[model samples]
Every structure is written in C-alpha cells, then in structure tokens.
Target chain A: MALPSVSRRLRHPFPFAILAIALSLSTGVASAKLRVVASTPDVADMARQIGGDRVSVVTIANPRQDPHKVPVRPSFATRLHRADALVVQGLGLEHAFIPALIEGARNGNILPGAPGYIDASLYVKPLQVPSSQNRSQGELHPLGNPHFNLDPVQGKRMARAIAEGLERVDPSGADDYREGLERFTTLLDEKIEEWARLAEPLRGVKVVSYHNDLIYLANRYGLLQVGTIEIKPGIQPTPGHLENLLRLMKRENVKIIIREISYDPGVARSLAERTGARVVPLAVMAGGLGPEGYVDSIQANLEALVGAVAESGSP
Target chain B: MSFRFHVGRESRRGGAALALILAAGSPLPVGAADSDATTLHEQLEATQREAERTRDEVAELKRHVADLEAAARSADATPTTTARIAPVNADNPAVSFVVDTALDVSTQSSWQSIGYPDGWNFTLKNGELFISAPIDPFLRGYASINGTSDEGFDVEEAAIITTSLPWGLTLKGGRFFADVGRLPHWHDEALPFVDRPPSIDRMIGGESGSEGLEASWLMPIDLFIEVTGGLYDAVGSENLETLNDNGFFGRRSFQELNFLGRIHGYVDLSDTFNAELGGSWTGIPRDEERSLWALDVTLRHQPGTQSSYQGLDLGAEWMWNSQRFTERDDGGAIMSRIRRRRQGGYAYVEAFFARRFSVGARFDYSESPEGAADRARTASAFVTWKPSEFQRVRFQFDNSWGDQQTNQRFTIQWTAFIGSHSHGFAQR
Candidate 1:
C-alpha cells in the first residue's frame, strides 16, 4: 500500500530535510496513501474492508482488548504521527485517550479544518441523551450518547463516513474507496441475513445482560430486554444490591446472561450459577477479535451468542 | 465520558479487591464524571487528569533534552542542516488527493422535548476536512471545523508531532481541543450508545479550548514513559479559571489559558496487568477563584486479567486534587448561585466486562470545609450493545443518593458513525 511514487512532482530546494524525506520516500509517488488509524479493531477492519489497498492503516486498539483501557504507547504516537487521516469510533466511545493523543501528536492534517480526521457518530441515531442537561447531576454528552459503533445499519453509514474522510486525505483513491465500499456493503448485506438466521432462536427471547451496552445488538437480533446485572449504568452492584438483583432475576425467570468477553464475568457468572442460567461471551470489535474485519467480528459474536443461547436451552 | 466513582460514604467500597475477581472488569473511563452524573464519568476524569499531566511533564522534559542537545552541539559542528521535504506529487491523477471533505447535516425531532430540546432545527452540524498524508513517519495532525450550537467554525486542533528528534522528542503548537476522560478523542461521540458520559457537559459547556505551545518526549525507562508540558493561556475566567486570583500574573486579569505542566508514565506487565502513573499542575487564572493541581495512578488487569471473563478490564484510579472553585460576592460558585472550594481527593474502582458492556461505581467525597458531603455518592451502571460496528445503543441508569438525598436517572443512547461515501481516499 506504500505507493511511494508521489515524489515525482516536487523538486526539493533543500536536499536534506524532514519534509523532504516525508515527501520523497514515504508518501506515495502518484497519490499519497490514506494513512488511516482506527481506534478499535472492529473500526479498523471496517476501514480496511472498504479502503482496500488504496489506504494504509495503523489500528490502535484490538478487538478482544478493552478499548477503554488501551494504552497510548509510543507506537501509538508514531502511528498518529505518520497518519494522513484518522478514522475513529465517535460518540465519545474512545472518550478516554484518543482526543488527547491526537492533540499531542499535533499533526496539522487533522486539525478541525483539515480533512484528516473522521468522527463516525455524525450519521448515527442517538439513543439515551439525558432528558435534562445539568452539571448538577454529572457529566453528560450534550450531543447524546457517544457510543455508535455497534449497530449494523449505523455501521454502513460509518463506512461511508470513513470513505469520505479518506477521500479528503487522499482524494485520488476515490474510485478505490468507492469500489471497496461497494464490496464491503455487498458482503455486509449478505452477512446480515446469515447472522439473523443463526440468531433466529434468540428472537423474542427474554434475556439479561451484564451491562446495557449491547442494546443495539440485542434489538438487532430481536432479543427481549429482561434486566441488568449492574445496579446502575456505571456503578456495579454491591452485595446487597446483587442480592436484590438475584431475587429479581429469579422472580423474572431470566434464563441467560449475555456478557461481553471484555467484562468481568464474576458477577454475571455468579448470577448464572445462582439461577441455573448460562453466561455467553460476546466479541465486541474487529481487531483483538477472531476474524480479520468488522463484519467478521460481528458475525463471530452473533455465532457465539447464538451458540451460547442454543446450548442454554432457552427456546 | 463514562464515569467510575460515586459520591458519599455509604457507597460501594472494596470494589478494588473485586478487581482480582473475574467480575471486576469495567468498560467506563476513569474520573470524568461527577455525582450529578453517572459514577463512570467522575472516576474517569479523576483517573485520566493526572496521567495526562505526567505525559505532558515527560514531553517538557524531552523538549529540555532536545534544547540541551542543540546547545551542546554547536551549529557549525552539524555536518548538514535537517532536510525540508516537500509534499508528494500534488497532481497525481490516480492518487494526488489525500483528504476527505464532507458536510454533515443533522436535524433532531424530539418528543417530550424537555427544556425544549425539540424545535432545535439541525443545521449543517459539522464540516470536516481530514488529511493524514505528508507521508512523514514522524509527523501527524488532526482538526475539525465544527458549527455546533456552542462555537461556530471552531478549530478543534491544529498542531504537529515531529519525532525526528532524539530520545523521542516532538514539538506541538497551535489550538488545543482535547477532552479529559476515558474513551479516546471524540470517538466517544461514536460510542455504540446514545447517552454520553455526563462529564461532557462539564468539560465543553464552558469555553472551547486552551491555545499554547506543547512539547513532549518518550522516555527511555524500563517501560513506556512519556512526558509532556506546555505554556498555554490557561483555562479562561469565562468558565475554568486555570490561573491565580492574585490578579498579577502574566499580564492576567484578562488573559486566557494559563501556565500548566504535566508528566505521565505507563508499563504493560505480562500483557494482562498494566500500570499508568502520572501527575500534573496548572496555574489558575487571575481572579478570586482558586487553582487546580492533581495527581492520579491507574492500574488495569486484562484478559479475565487474561480468562470467559472474556476481556476483563479492571482499573482502580486514585486522585488527589487541589482544585479551588470561586465564590462570587454572593457566596455562589456561579453568578446565579453560591461558589465554594471543591478541593480535596477522589478515588474509584473502574471495571469493563465486555467490549460493548461497561460499568463503574465509585465513592467520591468532597467537602468545602463547611459544606455538606457536597460529593454525591451514587451507584451507576450502563449496558452497551453494538449490533454492528457503526452504531451503538446504550442504556444508562443510576441509583444515586447523595447527602441524604436520592435521585435516579435512566437514559438510552443510540450513536451512529456515517461516512461520506461520495468522497473517497482522494485529496489535494
């Protein structure tokens, strides 16, 4: 993907300089490659899926890893330094470090005015914005929830956003990006039905999750909302709260606990043990995930969730 | 924006001990929240603020190193000046374009419309032009020209990182628009769910950004340690006063952005347990308001801490802050109400179970010497599910009781990331 042919256009007045090396050696000869960096494996995969060979990617966080905890190592800075553009999961999802990292890297290509930065939340529908906007309560994303990376329909739009950001950074690769998007969507459309079929049994099934994070997925698969493992959205349940939740789960007759692999299974596992329910491991993103890309990663989770449910015998 | 710690004494304690268990993983960021918000945001903000400073400190150290190196070696001794490479072929028909430009138009039609959240017609919400080209391995930049209700056409960030120096040093100068909390950059905006960590309101509701000069260096420690520090116009008096109230600092009394510095360090042990320790101090603005200086340490255990606990990320963040809030003549913090000191310490245990699932419950106590428990000790939890890669749906609910008071909030969020397919990997 390092099409170093971009050097043909410039006659550097300075023989030895940093910018010269950047232009003559690294950037492409005919077209500067879309140097894209995605926050998570899933997002990275999606970019690659639609970006094809026209863009060079340096994925930051892995799929299997907890993105919230991913460190901003020197390598990450190096990745940011070289990037012509960055494609990130918007919605404040990577709210932890990506913003600061981008600022520190100080690459002019991505400042607000540049086309080197892509925020994927613009096109997605916002779900749980606070009914009231008041600091008296706590910090809130006035724009809405910052998590928009898990919905398939939104996923398609995200791809389009990435493609647009890429085009701005590397306009010559427009055709390639277009073709990549077409192929990516073609595969995505096919995969959706297959995923639905695999998860057919889960449709209309009452289920409980360790966290309410997977609402998009559950809704997509037609999983009914039962309850939660935590007492609040961020605060974990104390023993007393857990005891009460256990009582509620038993009363509600919740049969399965759908938890993501990145979460602490201790509570969910305990609940499953107490209620004779099954705990299923769900994959979150693409990188750190089983497959090579976003679609494959989701498919993997779909299959895994279905497999966990089918074996649990929840009809 | 996710929070981790709650406020009050009768909150969930010893959760750090649970960190060793398979259930201790939390998906929320450190101390980016407050009692009024979900516990996740408080913990995230507290956790990240200090670490971010340390990184800055390291950067400042590296800048010193580079400057020292230059001084040690005379300009004449240098064989040849560094190269100034021109950009790649600007007219390559097949590849010259290396940026994406798009106009994002969004309109909201709300029901209930509390506070008239409805009727706010969506305009051309944002216009972005992103470029990751230049092909320089040691340089990068990011920016966004936005038209949100706050400030129109604001430059989010416009800086550069040049790693062509020794000891991994880099230079950065321009506008700064980075938020403090968990979740990287604005990616939180693309979270699978709709509701953002409450910290967003606190961070952005005020003035937009701090402009200045920043320098950094990647340390050569046993592990990965980075130092960064800057001399910027501190947070203005308009919202966050990052200067002293003495009214006699740096031509202050009317200056924006203050003099602040920070340093950060991190280590990854065995791919499962990771530790990041950092500290930072900022000069408050010139006003009657107090200043802030904070220090924090964060540790995370992964893989179950590596186990069906799938990917368990358990983090315990402890922060000690010397943050001084201002009280107006009427003893109010804001113009309309009372103001007081919000100093002291905060700590929390954060956990993220799955990629799409995260929850943080924390106990934070802040007293103004004569104020009530001021800190709201509450329990909060969030369920996030990403049906696909581009969209996230989140259900956020909290059971918070602070100062003998109880308040509960339930929110659902759906976030979508859309790409402008019309523009591909093409740029000028």
Candidate 2:
C-alpha cells in the first residue's frame, strides 16, 4: 500500500522529482573523468597522450587486428555506451563496424555531428582519394586511404584533433589537454628529425609494399614505391599479378618488400625469393612495437626499413 | 674591442683612398662618365619595369579577392533558404537487392517441404529488396519487400524504430519479426543452414513475423544485456492455423493478442572467443493459456590472425510449449478437455578450415504439435564456399525419419547480394 502511494505521488509533479534530479547531478559531478572510446589502437594512443590523467581511453579494435574488418564485439558497444567522446581514425577506416557500434551504443553525445564525436581525419589532407568508385577496383575508401595513422607526421595532427575533442567535452581540462598536445608535438618533432636522418640511406631507394598502406611512409622517407603486390586494394594477389609484380620489381631493382605483420607472410616471402629482394615485416598499428606507443612504433619501422636497405647493399 | 675598432677604421681609410684614386682617374676620361650615365639609365629603366609588374600583380590580387568575397557572399545568401529546403534525394534511403536460387531433390514427394517445392525441382526461390534510412534525428525507418516467382511479392518487414529515446530505451512499431528466437529473426538466405531447423519450423510455425510494437532496453551495466518486450496483433499465421485447426491455441475475441518477452546477454570469454545466450517467451493469456518458451546459446572462437581461415562456431536452441486443447464430437457437443506439452531443439557445429570453405552438420528432433505420439528427427550436413563476402554457395544433404514417412533430400543453394547490404552487427 505504501509502494502504491509512493508511485502515485511520482506519477504527478512532486518535490521528490526535484530531489532526484539534484542527487543525480551531484553524483555525476562527483566522479567526472571523461571516457573516450577510440576505433583503433593507434588513435587510442593519441587520445591517451592528449587526455593524460583527465580522461580514460578504451580501444575497440585490437592493435594486431585488421582495421578493415574488426570483429564487432559486445564489449565495444558497452564501452561506447559509456564514452563521453568517440575518437576515430576516420577516412572510412572503421567503416565496417563503427556505424553499428555507434548505433548500438545509443549515446546521443557521440553521434556523427555531436560535440563528442572526434574524427581525427578532419585534420589530415588524405591521400589516394578515388575520383570515382567501382567495385571492380576492389574495396575503396571513398574519402581517401584511411591509413594516415601510419604516417608519423600525421600523428601530431591526430593528437591535436583528439585534444580539441577532449576540450569540447571537458572544458575544465582544456589547459591540461593543450599542454599535453604541446608536449606530444614537440617530442614528435624531434623524433621525426631523428628518423629522417636515420632514413637518409633510404632516399630514392626503390621498394614495394604488399598493399597501399605504406604510401604515406614512402612519401615521408623519400622511398620510391614501384608497385604493390596486390592487383587491387583488398583483393589477394593473383598468380598473374604476382608474375607481373616480379617482373616490375626486377626491372625497378626494388631492394626491399615491406609487408604488414598482420597479413600472411607467405606471398611476400615468395615474391622476395623470386625477385631476390629482402622482405621487411612491419606493423601498421601501435602496440606491436612494445609499450612506448606511437614514437617507438615509428622508430622501429624506420630502423627496419633502413636495416633492410643496408642488408641489400643499397646506397 | 678597441683594437677591433682601430682595425675597422684603418680598413675604412684604405677604402677611402682607393675611392679617391678612382675618382681622380675618372676625371681623365669622358668615356667613363658617359658609361656611368648609361649604367644609371639602365638601373632607372629596370626599376620602372619592376613597378609596372607590381602594379599588374596588385590588380590581379584585388580581382581574386573580390571574386572570393563575391563567392562567399553568394554562398552565405543562398544557403539559408536552400539549406532549409532539402534536396530531392536527401531522404533517399540505402537500398539493396538480394536473390537466392536453389535446386532441391527429395526422395519422398509426400513429405512437407516448408516454403520450397517438393520432388526434383529447380526454383527461383526469392529475391528481396531492402531499404532503410534515418527518418529524423529521433527515428529510423526500415522496410523489406520479398518476391518469389510463384508467390509474386509481399512485404516482409516495415518498421519505424526510435533512435533517441532516453534511458537506454528503443521502441519499434509496425510489421517486423517478433523477438521470439534466433532462427525466426534471420532471413532464409542469411540462415546458417539451407533452411531453418525442423524444431523452429514445427514449434514456432515458421517465421514469426507479425504486426506489433516492441520495446528493447539495453541495461546500463558492465556486461552486455538487453531486455525486450513486444505486443502483436497475432503470432505466426501457420501457428494460428495449426492451433486454430486443432482448436487449441487460438484467440476467440479481437481483444486477445499475443505478448512476448525476451532477454539476451553476451560475454567475451577472451580476446578471440565470445558467447551469447538468449531466452524468449510468447503467449496468449486466457482461462486456458497457451505459451511457448525458448532458450538459445552460441559460442564462437575467432583467432586474431587468419580470421577468415580459422574460426569455430557452436550453437543450439531448445523450445517448449504448453497449451490446452478442446475436442468436439460430431453432434457439436464437447467430448473431452485435453492438455498437451511438447518440446524440440537442434544443435550444430561449423568450422572454417580453409579461407573460403566451411563444413557443418546439425541434428534436429521435434515432437509434432498435431498429436502427442507424432514426432520426427532429422540429420543434415552441409558444405559452403563463399568466394567473397557478397556471394555464397552451399550443398546440403538431409535425412529424416519418424511418425511421418522417412525421406531424404539433396539441395544446392546459391545466394548473392548487390549494393549496400548489411543486417547490422548483431546479425552474427
């Protein structure tokens, strides 16, 4: 009988409603740490670098998992549901599952146009944006290649975008985020210069990557990208394509073949053996280079490339 | 510092003496003066030419800025009115078409074939067109139209779902598959097997599509849990027909409707392994009520590497129903009152041992709703090859034996899709 009476009072406007609202507000303010969810591991690293102690970051896709086809797990949606902001590598990198996760999360704060939705690609001038799309050309990112995270120089821009998103959601931590971004960019500048020096021997060196993933890296290091092993973007290399690539590699005198660690190494190794080129396995995302995150990952990539070039006895 | 200044002064004095000697030498030649005048004139002409170029460049810059400002003004003025008026195709939804075809051969012609034709028959089974779009900030709309060569066409699902409901609540209204069990929710072409399990076909009376309203709540907790409740005008048509023919589980008045409730939970056992469990119930309330309850579970393991070629799946579902039956005599007098309970289930395991190939087998057992003594069991095995994400071909063999005549079937099915086609993340 008392429960019925209480419910009846709730049905109408009463002082309890105001009290409940006040209690909720107090609880929300008491434990205010911004929750950020990133679509990929590298973006998560950038978020952590910029968010610092003011925010907690969770990544939906594992570092070693293929970004193009991340398994839509239940925990990903749950994490997104509680996130104050959602950071994405963008440029259609997470196209397969991000939309579904966002819809499943049912969080209005992180919708596409909402303040908490941070698209890191907005700060990047993307490469290889298709002029027109056709399925015959294979899986295409209409906006551009979504692998800008592999470019160390673009890491600074991604961090700035993440910092701005954090400041938008948590104005109280704006100064902290700004300081974190400054520190990250300054360190990145020094590392970029160091890597450039280390990459001096790779200048104008001919190389072939398994996919279009290494285009930005080649652009940064002055490596001449002769051709890719795959016939099309997502398609596996056909036998005919491989034969053609072998001829092209030999003709171009390609010294190194860069293959992402996540992909199967058999094809890359086969081509390397046939063409007499060295195969260098590299991870496209963070966490594969140990615990130091983005800086260490880029440094390791540079070292691997330089080492491969040296082994090939190339200038 | 003073010594450096003395050196600088001495150097300057020497330069002055050199200049004085040059000036005195210059007085010895009118040709030198003429040459100096000529050099000064050349310098003057160069400065004039440079000024002219600067003037032209400034004019070009002004023109460019004016054009930019004009374009900005035009853009600013045009958008307020045009932006408010949406484009003709602004609301155009994502549309996709899928077609499924099959060749089915059965040993016994009298056996029930569900939706497929019996005996040696090749069929243009069906083609489906799906359309979906966000209706507004708060609503999403989805519709699917299915057409078969023999059945013409029908609307399978058309629903408006709430997107911005508060407190983890989503409301869906219109015709849609009732959230009763896993198999009923999937389209035929998307099913793991060539067709639905025999248990689902017998227990749920085929696809449980209905005109209803459903509300689902994603519980705010650490784990993934969703609770859903639905009210429908009626259950499956076959269910109504079967129960109504048997005078068991049909409603007498328009006020009577079917109600359903389901709870689903998912957990990640590891980075590469996950499991999902769901329980569902649907019933019509009356003095002698009719109700069906189902429990389903699925476990999946997908390695992070070579995910396409390395994966395992195991799934099973069991359903039980309780109902009251009324028997009548030829003289229109009640003969007896009967109560019946029946149960059935199916289990299957599939593994991807190669990049584009998978093989699986299923065992199905179900007691007929027609009578207590009527029952059937089936064993089926299938091999599937998917050339790409959009295309699949499967060959299946089924053998059934029970109260009905024993039969065997061989079926080959091909399914293909075009355009943007996806059933969302929860499809798997």
Candidate 3:
C-alpha cells in the first residue's frame, strides 16, 4: 500500500509473538484470570476445579490450619490486587480479619455490593446460626455455622454457585466453567454417599471433638457430637474448664473424644486417661490429611471414621 | 453450642452439670487397657461434681453479661421502644427493628460580633435515620450541616459503608471524612487519658471532607507486623477553589496526592511491658504554600500481671512544619517555599492505670519561630468508660492557660456499630 505503512508493518513483525505471550499469560497470571482467594484448602481445591486452568486460586489457610484462628498475611493485599473475585465461607466461621481484609483491598468486583463477590454459605443450607454470641455463654455463629464445606452435597452446590458467578463476570469461557463444575459435583455426590455408608458403623456413636466445627459431618453419620475439648474457640481449657469437662464425661460415661491433628493432643489425651474415653480426632474440611480432590477427600474421611470407630468400640 | 439435660438429672443435681466429665469423655470403646479404669473414673467423677456446681454459676454469670450487652446495643438505637422477647415457640421466625438518631447542637460566639452577637450556633450535628436488622446487610445515609461561628453552611461528613467486596474488603464512598489522623477525626471520639496530644492534633494541621475516592489497603504482612493504608483525598471542602466557585467550571481544588500513610509496628519487649511504636503522616499543601510533615511516636509499658498495679501506656510525638504562603481558606496553602520554616513540634506523655480507671495528661507548646504570630500552652484531664466493645462514654476538660486564654469543655459521646443490614422488605 503506502510506503510508510509497508515499512511500519515490516518493522513490527511480532504480532504472532504477542498473541502467544498473551495466551501464555492467560494461564500463568493467577491474579488476572478468574482470581479466586479461598479461605481453606478444600475451597481452594473446589475453586481450582470449577475454574480449571483459567483461574488463579490462592487459599488463605492451610488444610489442617484451624479455620477459626487463621491469621492474615501482608501479601494478601497484593493477592487482592490480582484477584478478580473472592469466594469465601461467610457463615461467621472464619477468623476476625476476614471482614477487615475484604474491606482493605484493590479488587473492586469483590466488594460486598459487587457481582463478582460470592459467599459460598449463601448457596448452602447453613446450620447452627445462634441467637447471639454474648460472651456470657459459649461462642456462637450468628449467621449459621460457617463450616458448611464439610458437607459434600453442600460443597458441590457451593461449587456450582461459585462457577455461575465466575461465568457471569466472564462469559467468554462459560461452557468450560459449567463443564468443570459438573464434573466436580458429579464426583462429589457419588463419594459423599459412599462415605456415609462407610461411616455407618460409627453412626450414633457418642463423640467428643477438639472444636464444634464438625457438627455437619457428625449429623450426616449420626455421630453424636457430645462436647468439645475446648471451652472456647481459641482458648485452651483452664483448670476449671478441664475439671468440669471431666465430671461431665464421667457422669455420662462417654468413651470417645474426637481430636483434630491441628490442636494440642496433650489435654485431650490426659482427659481421655482420666475418664477412660477413647479419643477420636476428626477432620473438619476436605484435604485435611486426606485426598486431594472432592471425592478423594470424602473417601479419606470415611476410612478415617471407620478406623476411629473400630479403634474405639462404642459403649 | 450443644447442651442437653435428662429430665431426671436436672432435678437431682443443683444444675445440669453433674455429668461434666462424663459428658466430654463419653468415649467409644476404641482401646483395651482402659476398660477396668474405674478408680480414675470415680475420682474424676467426684471432683467434677464440685466443679459442676461452680460451672453453673459461671455459665449464668456469662449469660447474664451477654444478655445485658445485647440489650444495651438494642437500646442505643431503639431508645424508647421496649425490647420484644423472642416468640414462645421456635416455629415462628423472629423479627425486631430499631432506629437510631443523633442530635448535636453547637454554639460559637465569634469575636467579630458584627451586627448582632455575630456567632453561629444551631443544629449542625449529624442526624441519621438508622434502620437495623440482626439478619441482614444495610444502607445508611446521613445529613450533616456544620455552621462554624465563621464558616456558615459547612458540610462536615456523611456516607454509608457497605459489606460487599470482591476480595473480602468493605467498600465506602460518598462525601465521607478523609482518613487524616487525630486532627480531622471525631473530636469527642479521642481517648481522654490526656488532652488531645498536640503532635497528633495542633502539629498536624488538617481539614474535613473527601471528594474523589478512597480504597483502604490491608497489606498482607506476616503474623507479627500488621500493615494497612488508604488511598484517599488530600484536600477538604468540595470547593476546589472558592475565588471561582462555579459548581460546574470551578477551578479544580488542589489535586489530592495519595492520602497520608499509617504504619504501626508493635513488639513485645518483655514480661512486664509491651512496647508499640506507631508513625503517621499525610501529604497536604500548607498555609505557607509548602507540603508539611507530621510524625508521632508512642512508647507504653505495663508491669506484669502479678504486680499490684495493673499496667500503663505512655507515649509522645514531634510534628514541625514551616513554609511560604498562597491562599486557601480550606487550609491548603502549599509549602512550596519550605525556606520560611513555619514549623512546630509537641512532646506528650499519657499513661493509663488498670485499663479500666486511670489518668492521662499532656502539655503542648507551639509558635511560628520568628514571632510573626503567637505561641500557646494547654493542660487537660479526662475520664473514660468502655462499658462494652461497641459502647463508650467520655468526659473531658481542657485549660488553655496561654495566648488562647483559659477555656474548658465538657463532652459526652456514644457509638453503635450495626455492621451489615439486609433490606429484603424494601426491595420486595
């Protein structure tokens, strides 16, 4: 065509190179693609599956980390900058800074009023919402228990909700997102039922746990969550709390104490010795010393439950 | 959160705590050796009986405290309405509503009493029609009119903060107060352990109003260091330039640089004292036409728990600024001429005893080094009560014994945080 245009086109021959770079970045840049910040490992896994390679996912707390007491990090702000969406459990189960962190970030879509925000609890049927958390009694979850991720069915549904939200903001790859969500939910539903059956022997068995975070899983298998080892969410039992717990277990003849790998086993062990109750530590979220994916997580927990029940014969 | 009582057991024991140890240790017979463990069990059973009685009292006390706090929070917003109890049965869903309103009436008698007692005082306080629900997210708007004895019809502060953010951050906008430290904060909300520390107030000259926007950044630091900052407006008054106050074509106000910075580093020194050092500063144009600097430090200590005296928090600061002048009643005269040295600094020490009850005092002295202006000194005392986390009241008195003459002030303040309210009824 024109002399200047021909020379400019000849000088800039990197169009193909630029497209390839964008394609590479599309997968490598975790913050820009559907950036997902999950609160726990299971949610992170779910987010990964639902969004697939199109998303950049980061979980704030580890699999075995106590979700209630998880601390926030400085880089979380930087993560927020790249995050296009935030998927979190919102039933009042997470640590304090959850609200503070969201309030202090760069991502505009994740703000409370924006469409890019998704609180997984909204899609699930939250349980144990308390009237109030007045310090006089015990801890409470004013918006229903926030630990719904433990329930496989609810977890799958939440994944679907998350996927839908991701698709709405980003319509370009909607089919891939829906397919990914479908595969995850289908696998989850099958595994959940199998786990329930495997845990059949432990159904209705009296149990004591480190934290009351396991009510959903317990209810599913009829494992009665008798009492918690801790009097408060983060506080270790005072001499008074331990002493009172001992008397209650003695009177009830409760023989099993549930434990999580994250907490100190010393107190629970001593309490077990004093009361003759078998101590059984249970996992609260998926990927908690279990398998990686949703179904694997359920299977791992089922096996653990069977072993816990067999190890500690029911009264 | 799970508590059950056998009908017969509640009657036998003083309370439902008789099975304290037995309840928590109702173990599944997982192992073998513990079956014949009757001796330890019996001993635990006996001690736990005693503990059960004590547990009942503690539980009731805690429950009572919780109920009282809930009632107090409810009362703040629903002043006159009687608190309705939950329905007799759980079948009926529960609903209770509350509305809170604030009335502030101020009086200022100006020296230039031109025609008639030339001072301005009226209902310039914040009036908010608050509607709240325990189970929902909310929206709030405020009407604020500030009538300074001099600057009439000034819009002080107003805005609504919401709970929806994509990355777990709360978002707020709409003519809100800029996050300028001790100076532009709610005056009555200041900690009265002593007079407002000069380094945070007088030394750091500031104004009110936020126009552009702000996004509070909560940097993800490690477990020890907590860091947060805000991107906000540097100038106050929507009026960028008054000399040409055309609402549409008005001269743009000084372009606000990134707002001030807040960095706090807290280190636990030892068993007795916990030391916290904080530094705060903002970028703003000065009256002398130069950008100024405001920095403060806090050093506090509290004897370990065993000591008869509970604890203490003592700290001080230094803020000096000097400049050349331009013109902006909004106090935005940039210090581009930093040579004039329009600077001043203040040193203050404030300590609180027992956390609950104590005294705080500070002495502030400032002047424009060349004597082209005036210098001042002030002493003060204040009492504070934090009945609960969301409720606090304070009483203060300030004596300016210097160039500004001796004047004292009395104030009472209250705050209620109705975090997120959902409005299903309105949208329907």
Off by over 4 Å in 2: A1-31, A289-292, B1-87, B107-110, B113-117, B240-255, B307-309, B327-337
Across B101-139, the per-residue lDDT of candidate 1 in tens digits comes to 212212233211111133323322233433333326555
lDDT of 2 by residue, B382-425 (tens): 99987656778999999888887888889999998877777675
DockQ, every prediction? 0.02, 0.25, 0.03
TM-score per prediction, in order, is 0.45, 0.83, 0.50
Sort every candidate by TM-score, greatest first: 2, 3, 1
lDDT against the true structure, each candidate: 0.53, 0.79, 0.53
Candidate 1: lDDT of A35?
68
The prediction achieving the highest DockQ against the true structure is: 2
Binned by DockQ into CAPRI classes (incorrect, acceptable, medium, high), candidate 1 is: incorrect
lDDT of each residue in A1-315, candidate 1, tens digit only:
111211221222222223334433553453456668888776787778878877777777756555554544433554565567777777667654575566445455664446787876657777777787643333345566554555676788788887777776777888888888888878778887787778888887677776566667766878876777655444455698778878877787777787765667778888889988888776666633456677766777777767777777774
TM, chain A, every candidate? 0.83, 0.88, 0.84
Which is superior by TM-score, 1 or 3? 3
Query: What does candidate 3's lDDT look like per residue over B138-184, in tens digits?
Result: 33344344443335544454555544443334444655555543333
